[model samples]
Target: MDWQAHARTLAAQIVRPESRWFEPLATTPRHTLVPRWWDSVDGQWALQDGARDPGRWLDVVYSDRTLVTRVGPVHADAAAPGTVVDGLPTSSSTLPGLVVQMFQHAVIDDDTSQVLVTTGSGYGTALACQRLGEQRVTSIDIDPNLVATARERMNLLRLRPDMKVCDVTGKLPGAYDRIVSTVSVRPVPASWLALLRPGGRLFTTIAGTGLIVTADKTEDGGAVGRVTPDPAGFMRTRQADDYDNPTREVWEKAQHADGDSVSVSRYPLLYVPDSWAVMSMLALDVPGIDHRVHEDGDQRTVWMLHPDGSWARATSGGFLEGPTVHQGGPRRLWDALERIRNRLNREGQLPVYGARVTIAPDGETTLSRGGWTVTL
Candidate 1:
């Protein structure tokens, strides 16, 4: 397959014609970085090998979609054929368009400016290297194996950037003029501000939501900015080999028990992750809600479980119908969600995007807009 031609075609579709990133997107070979990945099949992850089906491989690689490269420390390249892992995704090659959008947010105009990016499959790092030389780009990942693999793949294309294995929340290897994270983080890391040069900019998403913050370093060792109008979401940053799996005991209880309260849902069932504004508001107000959905024929069931022993299960026969909800524990999970929905209905939209953001020296982030305020 003519991968360069395919990349050019993809570049034309995704990159703005007048943008400086068009040439970089056109020339980068994404297939080299993502030779194997995982695909979700029936709510489970299935390995997809590019060498096994080159035609399908070329199609998926050139298309605008995220390719899951690792799930619970199982890199797709090392997995056997037909291997299926029932765990959350640990790393991925983010969609090319989103990467370009993030770069655009960073406003990398001068070639002399140094930038630090999160290395996934090294695809985004390759784009950065193409625009600014390898000397100006540094990419890091928490997984040592992923960093090594990405370094090897980039070598195949003769595109080398500084690749390091370092936890994003910890101290960085060097100072940078711009820090752009493709992974989500909670309570903007103070290390980022300390490592960034004065007048440097940082772009990242809030954990569990699509809130994209773009802040420039301030003189007071803090940063002040606003959430971008555009929404972007990414997997949370992990410090260990793998994220902790949900406790089986908590899952069993949330799945079977009818708790302290039972009532009819005031609003239709909502999968909070689907909506940018709704998810951002809910995640900020009541963080760490594990959501799951099940569908059997005409019936659909939605479950919301919290680590704090709060759980809510709602079932409905159709999309428009209200769900019968059962709640247990100290907090009413469904009631909190309903209140947010009600507020959204009243205000027409949640003021998460474009909200003014203030980050203190101690990593406290305050987001405010209109008359609402939330501090993390």
Candidate 2:
């Protein structure tokens, strides 16, 4: 297959020819790096092998979309045909557009600037290595198998960077002038601040929110920056092969039970997952909400569960009508959401975006925009 032609098409679609990232995206073989992936078909895992059908493979690989390379602990490369497993996505080759966005946010401008990048499918690292010399990039992941396999894939492309297996929140492999993570982080990491040079920038999305934080290191080892107007949602960093859902029982109980108190909500029964802005603001205020949606015939139900034994269920007529809200446990999860949504509707915007962020040397983060401020 003429992969270069497809790559060129992808580059043109996402960037201009004069852009610094155009040539790298136009030449890198994403198909070679991610030959197999899983596509969710009817909520079930469906494996897609590139070699089995070169046409479909090149079409998907060259497209500006994320490809799931692993679910739970099952890597697509190792899964048998028609194999199905129930688990969340553990790793992926992030969409080329978002990869470029993350790198561009960090301003990885020079070949001499040492960069630290998160390694998932390693396609992102390839782009970074292409932009900055291979010796200038250090790639890391929590999974050893991923690190090893990605290293092998890099050699196949004649692009070798420093690849290692380590939890991104812990001790890093080396100091860097720039750090860009494809994974989400919470409160930021002190290690990142300690490792970055003064004036060096760090870019990452906040956990449970699509907010992008761009902070530059200060001389005192802290960083000050703002939540850029970019929206990105990446899986959070994991310390193990798979993630654990601690709020499953709370969801089960909340899903079928009548609430301790029931009333009509002032808002419609909107699917929380589909509303990024509302979901993000709620996450900042409430945090750790396990959102679930169920639709039956002409009725719809939205379930919000928290590990704190708090659960809220809202049933709607599925016709833009207000929902009957039922809430239980220590906190009123839906009530908190409504409060945030109320502010959004009242003020045309939320403070989570374009908010100035101050990160202490210990990774304590405080975000402030105008009179609104929050600590996470």
Candidate 3:
């Protein structure tokens, strides 16, 4: 396969030729790091091995797409042929465009050294190694198998980063000038602050939202920056072997079942997840609510459920039309969503996207813009 040519084409689309990331993205063999991956088909994971069909493999690896490397606790490389599983994705080789985009937000420079980055499929770390040199990169993952597998695969590309098994939210391996994570995190981890040099920076997305946060470390062991214009989402940082899904009870309680109060919405039915601004704001104002959608022909229903037994169900004749909303539990979730949507309609925008972020040493984050402020 003419991998170099394809890589160049991909790099052109992902990054400008003059950008430092261009050469790295164009040269790194992503296929080497992700030999096999999972694809969701009919609500189950179907494994695809690159070795079996080199042609399709090259196309997939070279394209701007994410490859799921692990689902539940199953790594695609170790899964047997004809393997199918029902589980949420645990890890993936992030799409190349977003990888470079997140790195660009970190603004890694020649003076920056000893960078700490997440090691998922090792593709991102490989790009870092290609750009900053392996000696300056320290990559980590909580899963030992992922750490070992990523280390070996990267070695095939003649790149060997210092990969380790460590939860990014806990004590880190070493101090560094820059840290970038492809995984989404709730509170910006305090360990990142403890290890970051005073003048260094870190970039990551908040879990359950598409907000990309970039902050520069302060002299007093804190950091302050803004939510960049770009948006992204990744798997939450898992401390254990796999991710825990939203409970079935939340779904059962919310899905199709009527609620304590029912009424028609003032506005059109909007799936909160599809709108980054709405979702980010909703997540900030009311945390821990799981959003789900059910569709049948022209009719669709959206569910919002929280661990505390709060739930909102909205059914629409069509996705774009006003919905008949039902709310129950400790709080009215659909009401909160309606307020956010109302604010969007009234003010024309939400502050969640471009809000300035201030992080304390303990990882408590405060976001403020205009007169709106929220903390996580």
TM-score (all chains, Cα) for each model: 0.97, 0.98, 0.97
Q: 254 in model 3: Cα distance from truth in Å?
A: 1.9
Stretches of candidate 2 exceeding 4 Å from the true structure = none
Query: What is the C-alpha local distance difference test score of candidate 3?
Result: 0.89
- Quick one: ranking by TM-score, best first? 2, 1, 3
**What is the C-alpha lDDT profile of model 3 across 172-258, one tens digit per residue?**
878898999988898999999999998899999999898999999998899999998877888888877777655567778777677
lDDT of 2: 0.90
Checking candidate 2 for backbone clashes, the offending pairs are none
Give all candidate RMSDs, comma-separated.
1.2, 1.1, 1.3
Ranking by lDDT: 2, 3, 1
Please give the lDDT score at residue 217 for candidate 3. Answer: 95
Cα lDDT tens digits, model 2, 52-153, are 999999999999999999999899999998788778999999999999988888888874479999999999999998888899999999999999999999
TM-score of 3: 0.97
Task: At residue 148, give the lDDT of candidate 2.
Answer: 92
Residues forming the 10-long window of minimal summed lDDT in candidate 3? 241-250
**Residue 67 alpha-carbon offset, candidate 2, angstroms:** 0.7
